[model samples]
Target: MEYVPVWIAIGLVIGVVGKLAMPGRDPGGFIVTILLGIAGALLAGFACRAADIGGDGGLAIHGAAAVGAAVLLILYRLVMWSRTR
Candidate 1:
């Protein structure tokens, strides 16, 4: 239960930051932000598990996760845009 709020807050922050990080005409709201954040967390965990690096200390864990998520989101947007055309 305690983790829920923590995750929510983290999600909001990540979403807002993500929005700011990639400028210009992204369409989304609170729900979209939450989804993006969740996706980010999931991607992070998956990468960690696949690489077998989460068990040990890594200087780039958080950075890698954020970057990975941002990349995914960007790709998503691009695909959506292309499809709409």
Candidate 2:
């Protein structure tokens, strides 16, 4: 799709922001980071849609995505931590 590249770029930026917010050694590499970001956006988008919040390219949607990314990052850390325990 035409939006794939734009999504990836946004994802990468969101992913980097998530990583920065939760500073530590990443268990996975770049691809995982990118996936996390993309997934975060998707999660937020869906939730917003369900809540009747349209994505009007505003700060609210972006902020939700960031929070989603941070949440996923935390979950990822917990999973990896449990596996190593």
Candidate 3:
């Protein structure tokens, strides 16, 4: 409830970082970026919660989130490439 904004901020940061970290140009626009970030954050939060990596801090931006975002970006690229080829 109260953590919605936090999650959005975290997502935005993670998404931007993920996009920047990835090599070469990626597709999509602002909405896609936002969605990617939100999804990445959610994935990381869930994984961390399941693995108990960050204690009980709920969903926040951290190493796991960054990694998750990167992973998502990589997967996105792979899928896009596969579709093109």
Model 1 per-residue lDDT tens digits across residues 1-85: 2233443444556767766666555466445755787677557645665687645434455555556566666676677668767
Q: Which residue pairs show backbone clashes in model 1?
A: none
RMSD of every prediction: 3.9, 3.3, 3.3
> Residue 19 in model 1: shift from native, Å?
2.8
Model 2 per-residue lDDT tens digits across residues 1-85: 3333444556668787766766666678666876888786667655765686744545675566567766776688789778877
Q: Report the C-alpha displacement of residue 43, candidate 3, in angstroms.
A: 1.5
Q: After superposition, how far is residue 31 of candidate 2 from its true place, in Å?
A: 1.0
Model-by-model lDDT, in order? Answer: 0.59, 0.67, 0.67
Off by over 4 Å in 1: 1-12, 21-30
Query: TM-scores across all candidates?
Result: 0.60, 0.67, 0.65
- List the candidate numbers ranked by lDDT, top first: 2, 3, 1
Clashes of each: 0, 0, 0
Q: Which lDDT tens digits does candidate 3 get at residues 3-31?
A: 44565677788667666665454567555
TM-score of 2: 0.67
Q: For candidate 2, give the lDDT.
A: 0.67
